[model samples]
Target: MTGDHEPLPPGGRELPALDGGLPLIGHGIPFFRDPVGFLARVHSSRGEAVAFSLPGRRMASFCGPQANALILGLQDDTEVDRHLFYDPLLAPLLGPGVGLTAPSELMKWQHSLLLPLLRRDALTRHIPVMFDEVERYVAPWDGHGTFDLLAVMRDLSARIAACCLIGPRFGRTMGPALPRLLGRLEAALFAFAVIGPRGPLPHGLADRARETLVHAIKEIAPRDCPEGSERSHFEELMRATGPGGSSLDEDTAAALMVNWLFAAVPTTALAAWTGVLVLQHPQWLPVLRAEQEAAFADYPPTTLSALHKLERLSHCLLEAERLHPPIVVLPRPAARDLNIHGYRVPRGYVVCASPGLSHRLTSVFRRPEAFDPDRYLPDRAEHRTTPQALIGFGGGRHPCLGATLAQQTIKVIWSALLRAFDFELADPEVREARTTVMRLPRRPCTVRYRRRKR
Candidate 1:
């Protein structure tokens, strides 16, 4: 019951500790294999705050509402420099100028510059492009052959990231190569995280991919940008200045693009999971369709006003994220000593919160393991009681800036897809995979799509 500054009472339990890690690798294997289960087990057996080791460093897993709020809602004592955790994985690709690694003032400036793109007016303007991208990507699905649903969604997302965020010309110019390049970049980043730059093949591929991205950015430099209505993020980057009034250089521009892609690609990947979960819960299909029908009775739900009416779709997505968040762990480096639920956490310690574990806690959620959008209903509002219960997009000082766009993009794409076709999972028992970072749905998760007979 004591505040963060208050000292622990005499003999009060210290942060519950859990350790059985391998000699050198520490808990890497177990932590990666079943991160959700591992954290949950530790929290249940140990306590709200459980300390564990991972490879080279000791870490603490903050669980339940009290610990989760403490970790996520940390103020004045902790900060999210991507270097804290993402450095080993993405720093090579994203560089240091992005919001991920930049200082507070720099990050604030970056966020302010990027805010206009994600605003309601901008998203509304960008809807046609999003719809076009989604429709064009799905046009070939004919409801005939089974396709990897996640793969399709990922590719589509990459294209949308290019088309809407960068420019349609860039998207089309890159064509299929953009996603392939992105795939290679992501794989290489993951590999680097696992083994360092050991293998020649992956390292070479990553190098080449980075070179290609840099070249692409230089090729499309603002001077080369076509006049008229080609909305390009590259141009935006060129025009934007830091807090010190310096325009983005090639490295910073390219890094910002990569960072933006990192934010976008994963959320869009989760769109596929949303589809899979909804297909598994067939009962919701009719409900979603009905809601869409009512919401867009007068016109298609592509506009900002129209998109707002699709309440049920939003609920379903919220529930899906609660059950299977893409970014499971939110890591922050303590900038100063801190007290969390009375546990003394020192500066430089990697304090973490897990949406993957917290979302499934029986204490906060009624039936944590179940898929129930009703938990967010007006009457229920389960997340209202907790400070940071639903952190699929993170929280605290620096939440995901693109979160609103991510949800809208997913909703728009799925709305169009569901209206156009009926989806049947090739394997109902398919599960989500943990690929070192995101909680992705299984590869080769196929689905049969049949065009809606209107």
Candidate 2:
């Protein structure tokens, strides 16, 4: 019998295995039932690092500080080939571009080109467009009525993302149809991932959507570019000169936009959870509303300088991000065989970290389950205590480049909403959004809003 402290044999290390599963499916049932809870239980009972199986795949799960640092610290010998996990699904919709599936070198280049567009200065310039889009979307919801939270937010976020990323030309050209089409494409991609590409739904839905989007962008991209100046987000991306001064072809450029949609669309939509959770807490409503009013009284949130002063709002959004992380799980493949917390992680083995689970650790959060934005306050800053504890926008090598844009978009949307109306959950029965890849507030969840008397 092997003792707990005994030296293990080659290729044989101690890895706690999660029990209770039916034949063939392994832990699939329990995992699908409640992924966040299942992972939390694994960390509590089996330790921070453990192993689990799903159908034909062998996988490892990591949690707590040590595991968090290992996976998100950007130093581990782990690499991501998203196509390995999402190829059958995402590749067709997002395209085989650098954003979807790229080697380290190409990914680095893509980040370099894209990051500048999403930086503070550039993002500030786009704030007006974002704010205008949010105002347009929410203008209708002012009167008293219960609106589907996820659907409304999805449409709101889609308009904001489209305005900022795709430019006003394509945005104006497509109008509301853009968001609806993109939503359809996004749904198709998720379905493909779970149920195979050829599974159930009609073929070419995504292909058609992508064609429409690409065709519109290709037409407007040139006109949106200044005749001689290197301005506009789309212009910068189009002018991105690769190694040896080479530029992206039409197809590749379109593919990058598709990939950016994958990153920007869902994350922005999921950020609406901030509103869902915040409205549920009446204690924070007045506080948030007061802060938003005062902040925008003298200075419009259409600039980053003014937006940065909304500390309470920032805390609320950060807390919401911690609770409802857009991308719930990050999976990495071991670049080579290595020992991770006594487990022999073979090359190509899948190791995943769930920010959703990590955010709820009692050791890291005072009251992990409760929503306390003040936990991010200067004095009690829990996230500051650990490097990887607050992974709202992910971390490590492939951290979200559109993070600043996503946050600013959320801030603008919420600021506009809080200023215009008072709202609460219509159903009052909160539920986690059922999503295969991303984490979002569930639909059928409605918010009743009434226009505030000035």
Candidate 3:
């Protein structure tokens, strides 16, 4: 067999390509309508590496774990380009300090400062903040009523981002308006994901929201701070400096913090999916509650010790993430004619890998469609022993940085909710809404809840 680097050896068949019937939106409609289903069908029929003539550019989806390791594992932009993949959508909201939109070297340097904030030690402090934010956000919920699960989860996530990510000072400054403005930012992201980025986006709305964020953050954020113990992520960002102690300006500082939210906050998707899945599989309800009872014994589940004891709950959440991944596909533009997964991908083709598809492959998971949390148990770790078997969090070299934070946040949220009240889905048949950014439960995913006697 010819190598990916070698030219289509003489009579070697060209990489299989598919073109949709539409003009401007070739295959995008199907992709947006049912991303996982369509992508899986394509990979099942065609070869692992297949190309689609998308609206503006061509895209090559490298399916399965091997493709994930090959495509997502690309460290630098030498072969594949991440800087351009989400630039148009993320540039406005995330600004440009330590992200795909910034210069590679500058991004690398800035990442050094930003990443520590998401580490175990740094995140330990945020645990209490997440619990506090969830409590305050859910305080308004009545003793018994029907509510939109997705909306509640989204609001809670925004609240946590304001206090934990932007700092409590920023949260207090914005007060009631914190989530409103932050919602505007998330809404823009939702629009981009629901409709494929190849389609039109609400750039104007995102730009206005970002300007507001930059202004608000610049007003309260310090230009620089003496290196020392920090209270929140923003404080650490204020202390970060470039070569020769080049201090961060107010605007850049604000934008960098916002960018961190994009990287650090896992949005409402994980928690929301966990909720829907838990409700769908009522069999696990008592299991999770029993685990929580023990985990929260004597100490709040926010503590590391308590959190570790909630192993079964964590396994159930892992099952949810595997079933309903937030983003259907992770795409990076190929820098040049590169050999990817033994396929000749030409320059500028958007190289793609779908965790949404890989997670459900029967080859990777036994009875891939079944909602069995036991699969995550140590003895039956089906996702183990493979490089990228579980790509739900975009595993491999470029895994999701916010994955740990997201899992912790969800566990905390569940501990609080499942302890305080008993909830049942008003519509038990809740399925994932078709959005690439957040796999929210479809509309009318209402839940009935009542305060429980502790």
lDDT of 3 at 248: 68
Comparison by lDDT, 1 against 3, better one = 1
Provide TM-scores for the models: 0.91, 0.89, 0.90
How high is the CA lDDT of each candidate model? 0.74, 0.71, 0.72
Better of 2 and 3 by lDDT: 3
Candidate 3 TM-score, C-alpha based: 0.90
RMSD of 2: 4.2
Residue 294 in candidate 2, Cα distance off native in Å:
2.8
Candidate 2 global CA lDDT score: 0.71
Off by over 4 Å in 1: 1-13, 76-82, 196-205, 221-231
Worst 10 residues of 1 by lDDT: 1-10
Model 3, total clashes: 0
Tens-digit lDDT track of model 2 for 361-390: 888899988889989888999998987888
Quote the positional error of residue 131 for candidate 2 in Å.
1.4
Model 2 residue 190 lDDT? 57
RMSD of 1: 2.9
Off-target runs (Cα >4 Å) in candidate 3 are 1-13, 96-98, 172-176, 190-201, 221-235, 243-245, 263-265
